[model samples]
Target: MLFCDPSMLPCYRSVQCIGYLSVKIHRFMLYTFTFIYSLGV
Candidate 1:
């Protein structure tokens, strides 16, 4: 069971968080991942 179903774009829209909020959040996650990767290397 998934507690947070972030796979659906409409999820954020349903909450009135705007259309691109998911994309922005995805970008932030990628950036943070890269930062942590570089720090570990």
Candidate 2:
């Protein structure tokens, strides 16, 4: 079993953080598109 080193934790964490941020951004874009489409009616 490979134990994660403290130094590597930040790098791993940053990648996870970016993934989470991108998910949020993706949702925001979808939400905005839906909202705009609804306004067209």
Candidate 3:
């Protein structure tokens, strides 16, 4: 079994948040690009 140190919880949470935010940003950029492409601009 693997053990997680209590002191590392914050670091883990921050990493999770960064991952989530990056995914959201990527999705937003993809949507915007598609919209602009559809406009032929």
Candidate 4:
């Protein structure tokens, strides 16, 4: 169960957005590393 008061809504939304972007950046880094490794082999 998640509950956010009106005053806290903006802060909560920003946290969620930051978390989503971090996950995406992590996946991109993983792909980049693998591609470089394959080229090096």
Candidate 5:
């Protein structure tokens, strides 16, 4: 809906995908760090 124009749809979708992947990667990194710290402790 925000990108109603056809020309903008691809750009909007790509941005959305990138945002989602970044969030997932960030969470994964956080969890990995926490797990490693716990093991070290």
Candidate 6:
């Protein structure tokens, strides 16, 4: 789901900037959502 989920655009972009590097797609998405949720954003 690399940048495919519109609702996750901001989170995805933020994660990208943080540098996922060569991480797996599912792992990246999971990390992004967890990070966002933790921020209560």
lDDT of 2 at 30: 100
TM-score of structure candidate 1:
0.54
Clashing pairs in 6: none
Best by lDDT: 5
Model 5 segments beyond 4 Å from truth? Answer: 1-8
* TM-scores for every predicted model: 0.54, 0.71, 0.73, 0.71, 0.75, 0.42
Model 6: ten consecutive residues of lowest lDDT: 1-10
Model 4 vs. true fold: TM: 0.71
- Candidate RMSDs in order: 7.4, 6.2, 6.4, 5.2, 5.0, 12.6
Q: What digit string (tens of lDDT, one per residue) describes model 6 on residues 1-41?
A: 44434466687767764554446666888999999999996
User: How do the candidates rank by TM-score, highest first?
Assistant: 5, 3, 2, 4, 1, 6
lDDT of 5: 0.77
User: Which candidate wins on TM-score?
Assistant: 5
Rate residue 27 of model 6 by lDDT: 86
Please, what are the lDDT tens digits per residue for candidate 5 over residues 1-41? 33334555688877876777788899999999999999999
Give the runs in model 1 whose Cα sits over 4 Å from its true position: 1-18
Taken over the whole model, the C-alpha lDDT of each candidate is 0.66, 0.75, 0.74, 0.75, 0.77, 0.68
Q: How far does residue 32 in candidate 6 sit from its true spot (Å)?
A: 0.3
**Which residue window of length 10 is worst by lDDT in model 1?**
1-10
Which digits, one per residue and each the tens of the lDDT, describe model 1 over residues 1-41?
Answer: 12234665666545545435676789899999999999999
- Per-residue lDDT of 31 in model 6: 96
Task: Report clashes for each candidate as comma-separated counts.
Answer: 0, 0, 0, 0, 0, 0
